[model samples]
Target: MSTNARLQANPRIDAIEQVCSKELLAQTAPHDTAPPGLSETRSDGPLSSADDVEQYGLSWETRAALEHSHCRLSLESQSGHSAHRTSMDRETSDTDGNTYPEGGLEAWLVVFGSWAGLFAALGLVNTIGTFQTYLETHQLKEYGYRSTGWIFGMYAFLTFFCGVQIGPIFDAKGPRFLVFAGSVLVVVQMITLGFCTQYWHFMLVIGVTGGLGASLIFTPAISAIGHFFNEKRGVATGIAATGGSVGGIIFPLILEKLFPLIGFSWATRVVGLICLILVLLACLLVKSRLPKKPASKENVLPDFRIFREPKFALTTAGIFFIEWGLFVPISYISSYALAHGVSSQFSYQILAVLNAGSFFGRWIPGYVADSLGHYNTLIATVALCLVCNACLWLPAGDSVPVLVVYCIIFGFASGSNISLAPVCISQLCKVENYGRYYATSYTIVSFGTLTGIPIAGEILSQCNGEYWGVVTFATCC
Candidate 1:
């Protein structure tokens, strides 16, 4: 049999030849009119008989030509699909070649987890003002203002300082155990805090223990968010960091009401219970997306070598100055109010008011930072902090109206300080090494936290309890 005869004899080859011939004709017809023989083949739709195939000049070579067209079209279609897929992948990846879901159920869930953890840890950090005021007049009344300041100073000190070690461990391992251990220490601190009356007791429970716990929880909480977001990081971190402001708002009100109803010990225990619940939620939902690194000696320890970079060193120094005065207001605002004859009931509420403004501050600047640039927004906010103190808080003296306005404006501006600092640090490093960079910067900043409050207190003492001198000190920082 001839080639056409053999092809026609085989049912499968006959079908393929017909399909390919029709497809080839349809493709060519779009751009140009079909040729005479091919036109007859197109009109018939298929070469049904061997005579039709011969008449149309549809030989084996023509059949091979049709098959080639089909293969070429398929390859082009696949190439288009492959290009589209690659474009999508590139859109999802960051500059460091890290892929993120950007925003998904899992990613948002992690944000929520970090938020809850921060609520407990940072909440206490924010409430240092209330804690300091209460301790000054009550348990530690005999101690000078500068002396009592050290307790809270130590609390803030260890909280960020330990991140030097905790950050690297988080980069190596994960958040699970670190969060759990931190949660335990924080819960223990809150539970035992009310029972402690001595100077050393407060230092041990609130200062040392609470700071360590907060460090472990704080570093991991912020770092885990880096794994799931890059583009929306500012807003997401702001949302999480607001947990602290939220805690600052609620905890003081809770203590104010509960201190009268329940007494200090049980009121604190109640706070502990709340923290326990929040940290538990964090433990369940917060997780790391990166592959685990082998916990070698180098991986587990903090390497200070990163500071060799000039930009990082400068950022760290800027943060140091920011943190130096940052805690002065947080540690002294309530006490300042009480000393100036503001009702004790309203004094505690003052911290809440500041924190309430901070609640909005934490996230709003973050959203703007996404568009304006992190460093720009941060610099503006820091400048605003200086303005609020110099223009409002410093000159207000006993004016409640001016102080309230200062609290709100300063609170809003300072809110970004906490939320954006980590983001600014993240800009200097990769997503995976975020913990180390953040911890290192804050570790240096921790010294400022350690000294800022005490320095303010000493200034207060030097000026014979006049707050202008202390306020001026904060304004300078």
Candidate 2:
């Protein structure tokens, strides 16, 4: 029977068979030739039957023309064939293009693991202010704010820079080993932090060890979610990122009560206990989606050629400035308040308020970013941060309410800068290479984190105790 006649006699059957055949072809196709618009077709060209074309879901005229063509089926047919081949490609291109792997108990459990891991890693970064405030008064009290700033600055630096090697390592080896090692290092650092009484000790335990632990946990924790969801990525990432905000809030409260009650060492031990629990959960749950790539020299080192893209270059610059400015406020807010005659309790509470706002800040703006455009959302957030510094923080001086308001607003606004930064970086690169891109970008930007607090500290010193110089420097950077 003619193809059209066959299709007409049992249209439903023809459609089902056509779909099945397409799926079969897709399953058998080589990966390199599987992506839509990237495949090569036969020189003999396509099937000539109008009915067959229609069965394939193409218009009659187009199908007939494609069938008659000397060249391979039109670009559209190649695209359609490609879509038919890979379920992932088809799902990704659809209206609700977001798709996840088989969803059920195991998938969600992995997400839970990621959430726990992120909570521990990012949580500490979020709570840096609490650490900074406490250390400035207790452990590192004799050091200038700028000098002590190096401790947290180095922490931030290592948190990001370690990602350079960690990303490639994760891609090659998976999260199992990485998360395990990181957990051990982080727990060790926390346990030792209570014993640290010197500058180099703080740098060794908190800066290097804590930073490495964070990088190990965070990079995989965030990257693993991409293995599970595409359409739901924004929500998943936001949910995972909230761990940081939660940690931020909890740590400050714990420190506030413990500092006066149990003293600094015990307070740190308490925080470490919390971290141990969270990190353990992370180690159990977080996993890499793709099978690990074989270890090779190519996969081991970072590729700097990505800077050839101007948009990426601009993004790196923006993140650098943001990081450069971010830690200054985090490290100095309490000191700034105390120097300006704000009450000690209020000064400490200010950091908590900032973190409280950040909880929503990380989640809401992330959802918005999925809709409004990641770069657009990021640019707006960066501007808000700048305004918070320039308008609210710059003039507050000794005003308690104004400073408190600034803390809340700025905290919320800056929260996205921390959480969404990886999302923004993901937008710029492919999923398989996300870890590498993210790690490389942050490796360069970590320099900004390293220097920012110290520079701000120096500015504070140069001003002979005023924060205006630091504020101005923050705004300018």
Candidate 3:
């Protein structure tokens, strides 16, 4: 038969699948559960699927396993040729393993669009300290640190929390409408932030509105890139994510300088204008290549049943811990510097420095991850976070050099943590289902985002305004 010949259903494929299923079941730990919507499918005969022989390449080991299996399997052709086969199909990609263009002007443009959108969304997330410090001193000076923490924490929570519904929407409708809507909300948040004077005003404008805008922009921004790159997904995602770090570095510096000249009201409007311009570019360029699927019950609504997959469950847990530790530093470094007697001028600069390091951190880990293993890179980078917290930041009070070193090392490591997370999540499911898995994982992780900063704030309060309590909590998480 020709290489292109579509082989029909065969016993070899069926037998190999049965053996693989049995092996998978045998390998599952007692606590591990089957994946949602997948494990429940079965029959007394071969499972229903259109997969062909070539798609299920069988090797010697597969033949050996079949020999031990109960099925009567044979791979010989009519001409007496011996057959070879290996593992069953692992990925359930909707497009059946489509190849990417890798690089082109159009492809690069899409990546750039994604970068710009994430810049507005995650960049603000990275620059939360600048806002937190200013808020404490200005509009909401009477509130305790824990109360302020709740505001930012809610912002962080909505950034991911709303993604549960948005992810499935992206999978069904495409990126254009979502990006457009996000652009409007973000502009509104920025423009309105300048006028807010009360604690509730900040909560409504920055916390809730801004958070929803970010979810609308970023969820679709990240999802659109996957349609264009598969082999180089790590590098592409890393490149796009650098926008957040770049935004982090740039925005704080702008606010630090502009706050005095323009004051809070106009400075935020300036940032809003900047966001508007970039978000326009994002709306124009970021697009999905996959044909849009109609809204289905599974794709339109949030489902929590995906937790049955143990790998996904463990991955989500790892993300929760990473996020739990991640924001404590981002939200408090400026405050920490001020408390340690650092100059006010330089206190604002520290966040910029941290973000500057993260710019480089995001790209390098991604470039190398493709060559190494995705999970391997993630594990190493997360360990870097723990070390930076326990060994470096914990003892570095009032020491300029120590703070600087901590910023560069920890900033870079945490940047890798942000960029690598979705990449690792991509490994746990099919490409088409990537959004579902990513959103679900983040929905669970959002609670960490919701509580982490506030808990850290309470820790700071408990230590009589000392940062060590928060640092220790961050290290342990």
Q: Rate the local accuracy (lDDT) of all candidates.
A: 0.87, 0.77, 0.83
lDDT of 2 by residue, 1-477 (tens): 665675456554444444443444445446664545222342444333464345445555644443344323333244365443354443442133434653445666777887777777777877787788778877788988777888888898998888889887877777898898988887888789889999999999989999999988877887777667665566667777888878878788788878889988888888889889988998888887677777888887778899998877888888998899988887788778888898887777777788888888888888888888777887898899899899999999999889989888888888887667878787777777878888888888999999998898888889898889999998887
- For model 3, give the 10-residue run with minimal summed lDDT: 83-92
Candidate with best TM-score: 1
Model 2, residue 159: distance off in Å is 0.3
Select the stronger candidate by lDDT from 1 and 3: 1
Residue 365 error for model 2, in Å? 0.9
TM-score of each: 0.84, 0.79, 0.80
What ranges in model 3 sit over 4 Å off? 1-95
Residue 448 shift from truth in candidate 2, angstroms: 0.8
* Candidate 3 backbone collisions, by pair: 57-86, 58-84, 58-85, 58-86, 59-85, 59-86
- Model 3 vs. true fold: TM: 0.80
Q: How does model 1 fare in lDDT?
A: 0.87
RMSD of 1: 7.9
Give the total clashing residue pairs for model 3.
6
Answer with 2 or 3, whichever has the higher lDDT.
3
Candidate 1: residue 211 Cα off by (Å): 0.3
Q: Model 3 Cα displacement at 126 (Å)?
A: 1.1
